[model samples]
Target: MAPLALLVAAFLAYSVPPYLTFDPALSRVPAPPGFAAHYGFLVAHILFGTIAIVGVILQIWPWLRRTHPVVHRRVGRVYVFAGAIPSALMALVIAPFSSFGPAAAGLNVVAALLWLGSTIAGWRAIRQRRYADHRKWMVRSFAMAMNTLLSRVYAPLAFLGLGPSYPKLGELIPAASTLAGTMSMLTLLLLSQWWLDRKPKKPAIAR
Candidate 1:
């Protein structure tokens, strides 16, 4: 977890600075048409996404949860209310205007909804004192939040891998983008379920 967190932090360091500049020229991808405030929502999504990812790192740290439970709960509240929910709402707003095309836009919408729903479920689980359910749902929520990282990783790979083989760069971009986002989110979701369901090995019998 520590290593993975470090990797995500590194990626965030690399990807987040340009957005912070708030210059339209510095936009990572071309802003889609028909939206006057696309850049504003993009920045908001990035900002809240960063907070949510950081919250996941802190929340999942066993040492933090064991040693500083109060901190864990407080951070969880911030994550659900301030980080995950707002970021997802922004995603819903911006996804439809995705420059990547209709397929990517639809996928983004689904991902945002899943992220939002899982987060709300996690919050409700904790409030209801269903610790087991809370853990499952929160882990799932973290996986959804992590689409930010995986999307970046996959997008370039999708371009490079598919670009040379395809003749038309324009036509390929949207397909690659859709494929990348879908694979990234799906991979995380499957992994999270596996992590949640895995059985611990039993101890050896005493002599």
Candidate 2:
């Protein structure tokens, strides 16, 4: 059921963007010169988003997580390396130049940095065999990755609440999206950590 839900979410995320055109409000906004002129950014985003989805699948599957630890590790490395790096770069490029203004830009920067930091920390925790820490960090990474989901949810809400003509309303969308995504991710991470902490540790027999 969990895997099925994740898969559905992933498909919705990957498919939704192609159908939506850029917001008109976004067009009038000042961005760094030539930011939208290149197709490479779009390509990179698709590539990384695809890989991140695949990584999530592997992370959630018990058989893959347990039986092929090396493959899992490799995939995870690809996920963090590709997902966070490209996202950060994209954010850096877009944030300042955002049509939505500084609120959106600032949130983008924060989200990108948090995503990068969580993935790095998760990778480090796993390397040190700190399973508890790894779990927490991975939750953070997953939350960051799930920002796509949050963005989708918030955009509609913003549009509905602010209506079409509201000038500043669009600016709130990105900020709200980022905040919601981060908070959701942190909540899940903390719950998982609590659960892990409560589990009984196995006893080692004396020689």
Candidate 3:
């Protein structure tokens, strides 16, 4: 039930933005110069973000997680390939457009790269039968994957914290959201690694 709720929330969060006709904050900030040429890039972001959310749902659901490892692997491969790669590409293209300037751009770029690197490393670890390493890398990858959702979570919080009269509250929201989401993911990843490390190692049985 929790996972279903999270999935629904993620979908609505991603889907609602493009349809918004007017936003005071968005209107105040000039669109990034050359936004016209890169409209397709934004489309790519929406596409990959949607795919990643679907991938996560498949990954976390118990019945799907346990009952169909092969199918999961296949889906995961598509998810990584489609979601991670294009997402990273779109991130690069859009990073310069961030109203928060270079620092925010750097963080966005790093986050995207981390997402790609962790995913690839996780795949490699699985192929090498290093399940521990695979799990760790995957945890990191998922952390990066969750950034999309985290950004949304942070925006409202930032708005509330800074108050309505705060100068540039709109601009600050996206940047703060990214930072908060990244930190949250990092904390969760560290805790997951610690828990996994403490578990008893399974003996390697002959196939």
TM-scores of the models, in the order given: 0.94, 0.67, 0.74
Best of the candidates, lDDT: 1
* Tens digit of per-residue lDDT, candidate 2, span 95-159: 55555546556666776777778878998998899987898888777766666555655555655
Best TM-score goes to which candidate?
1
After aligning candidate 2 to the native by TM-score, how far in Å is the CA of 105 from where it should be? 1.5
lDDT of each: 0.90, 0.63, 0.68
Residue pairs with backbone overlap in model 3: none
Report the alpha-carbon TM-score of model 1 versus the true structure: 0.94
The 10-residue segment with the lowest total lDDT in model 3:
21-30
Model 3 lDDT per residue over 1-207, tens place: 486657657655656465254442443234577576455566667667677767756765668768999888888887778877677678777767866666666677777888878888988998899987987887777777777566556657655665554567666666565555555556656765676667576778832
Candidate 1: which pairs clash?
none
Give me the overall lDDT of model 3.
0.68
Which stretches of model 1 miss by more than 4 angstroms?
204-207
Q: Write the per-residue lDDT of candidate 1 for residues 1-207, one digit (tens) a residue.
A: 868888898999998999988998998768766777999999999999988989888998999999999999999998988899999999999988889899999999999999999999999999999999999999999899888688888988888888877779888888899889988988999999999989877778732
Better of 1 and 2 by TM-score: 1
Candidate 2 C-alpha error for residue 85, in Å: 2.8
